[model samples]
Target: MSTFEDLAELHIAAEKLLMVPAADEWLLRGSDRRLDEAKFRKVMVDLLSAVNRSVGITGFVELVRQVEATADPVTGKVSPAAGAVVLLALEQRIDDSVLEERISPIMVVLSRAALRSMNAERELIGLEPLAVLQKAVIPNEEILFREMFPELAVSVDGYMVTAVGSHAQAITPVLVNAANPASPMAIGPLQRQLRSQVADLTVKRATMIARTETARVYGETAKETQRTNGITRSRLATAGDPCPICMEEAARGFLSIDELKPIPLHPNCRCDWIPDVENWLPPMPEVVQA
Candidate 1:
């Protein structure tokens, strides 16, 4: 049976390869270019269906709302502006998934440790779904360790490593599913089911992209914690939250002023950095008051 460790490892690998560059290729083409509206709608519908299957009904509804809200009225299509908005939303969902992936490993490892230390099935009384969940999560860890520890370590790899290695191969299924051109399901419930699955997967795909970017940013080794010096950049910008580094209020500013940075912040940072040449300038140093 699979242990949480096995499942966690699988998740890590899955996270790494789940989103590919090609996943957003269609979205990118929607800008300025006159894309086939029929094709674009079809793509969105397929994407909705896939997300519904994996996540459920609520996810699909949310995705449809986002797509509708962001779609361009001018062309009856998704424009760069809409694409940008949806992409950020996609990024937020990914952030949640990343946290989920990191914590899941610990859960699996600890659960197995408990089971083995006790050595009795009855010791797991009232564990119910957790017991089953653990089994499903890490089916092969103990077996592999007993059967081949050193070899397994050599052959297999850490979660991040395996994830990076497998990401490209994993993209195909997502692409095929998201790009499916099938007619919408006839039944209402089935249609709902399809949308939920597609929405969930859409979010998952975003998370995968975030993970891959994170791995790329961190490289093979651990990254040192970066210290940022908050500097205000522009006064002619939006007044609410200023960019810490350059105090400007562009539409794509980070949530916290302290979080502001160049595009692709923290491997998975979906915050965009656009150049407002008219407003761009170095932040003035704070003067000490007497």
Candidate 2:
């Protein structure tokens, strides 16, 4: 199973890969004399599309592997039927609905920031700031993942999966200097802020994907253990020194598999549950009478 640290590292790597181009574009557009509403919109759309594509391709592949590794052994044998079922369940659980719920608002904030940054750039160039327009269309999660990783396959009995990661977070609120008109707005500050926000968003999306996949894998693993090995309970384990809340929760001891919930008492949670299997062998029979 991929450790939480491993997952985080993957997110960081992928974010960096995508951020290079994003930063370049933001800088290029900031200096353009012809920058207008239409051009600004185009840049926002292009950035958003790149984010979706990078996360879908990089995050999804890692997530699928983590889930698959937990549910099935890596014995170098392919099981298309089983793999298909697993893929379907994961797709259903972590589909567009899930992505939209977590990422749509962030994207909105990003689009707005992008527009604001453009305006700041224009102001620095002795031009009036353009009014912000309606938000750009957020990329579709289904299309992103499907285009990147359309199918789940196995080769030589091992699942084929790719790995990637990077880091980012939410945008800080934009603070304007409304006290003076024609005061040169600093494009540098705005660009830096946008860059950080984009990086933050990348990390957030990747963490979310990992959390969902881990939960699904835990649930399925528990079910399988119970069915095949008569395991009925699971114990919670923390990856390192757990937080006060997780430590308190862990003190509760083992619980029935049905009663147990996946750990990550909060975001960036590094806890997991270990199953306890009961001995299923029958007792020896008493000696027969002569």
Candidate 3:
């Protein structure tokens, strides 16, 4: 089994590789570019605005806010995926709108990594174990990183286990002195505050992108496939009971006992479990915000 340190190293490497182009783009922002650059840059900004507005639900919105607070002001590093996508469009130098053209690739890389990782884990452990891991690991980040830095081939394997401890410490809020919405007269101040926060998010995005790409480029090989042909020798093992978190019956024929991997029994979950499983284990619990 892979260690968390091993996975963290890979993540760091991936980030570094993707960072170069992102940093370069930031440096070249006001420099010469054909009409193409101007057009796409506008599109990129629009897409980013849309992404912020539609970033999951309330929790995710708050998460973005927190990320922005700590992110570098100059780089706008709140979410690396944004930078990766922009870099991708810039590289193509395509005249098309960056958002329409780039969102798919970003989504594709994220989805593929997720499915492939789950499939591999399913074959190695049991379908239940894999499902639990899927709830835990979240391959989207790795995929986003790799796609932004295609030259750096990344695969999602042990990122979940490594991400758990870090995630615990990573949830600090990005404080913003948001203007009082009730005071309509403060509109200008509110806009300025929002702009600052948005800038922070941009930097965070760039940093994550760099880490993911670097890891993919110079990291250890991902498991080719835990099983052959995607066919498990045994049926997906089940718990024969309802999952505590979802309250849905655990599908029959999956692996894992109830106590060790109880709630949030699927992969990429937001819930908690007591004794976390190895590489693809569920999280311990969310910290209570003060």
RMSD values for the candidates in order, in angstroms, are: 22.0, 26.6, 20.5
Give candidate 2 regions above 4 Å deviation: 1-182, 186-189, 200-209, 212-217, 224-229, 262-268, 277-290
Q: Per-residue CA lDDT of candidate 2, range 1-290, in tens?
A: 23223333233222221221134555655433233333433433443455445454334333344334333232322245534443454344333433333333333333333334434433432345543322223444223322222221011001101111121112112212211123423657655655666555545544432233333333353345344444567777765667887788788898787777654466556566655534434224469999
Count: clashes, candidate 1: 30
Q: Which numbered prediction scores highest in TM-score against the true structure?
A: 2
Error of 2 at 283 (Å): 18
What's the lDDT for candidate 1?
0.32
Q: What order do candidates take by TM-score, descending?
A: 2, 3, 1
Better of 1 and 3 by lDDT: 3
Error of 2 at 42 (Å): 20
Q: What is the C-alpha lDDT of each candidate?
A: 0.32, 0.39, 0.34
TM-score of 2: 0.33
lDDT of 3 at 134: 49
What lDDT does candidate 2 reach at residue 195?
61
**Model 2: residue 84 alpha-carbon error in angstroms:** 41
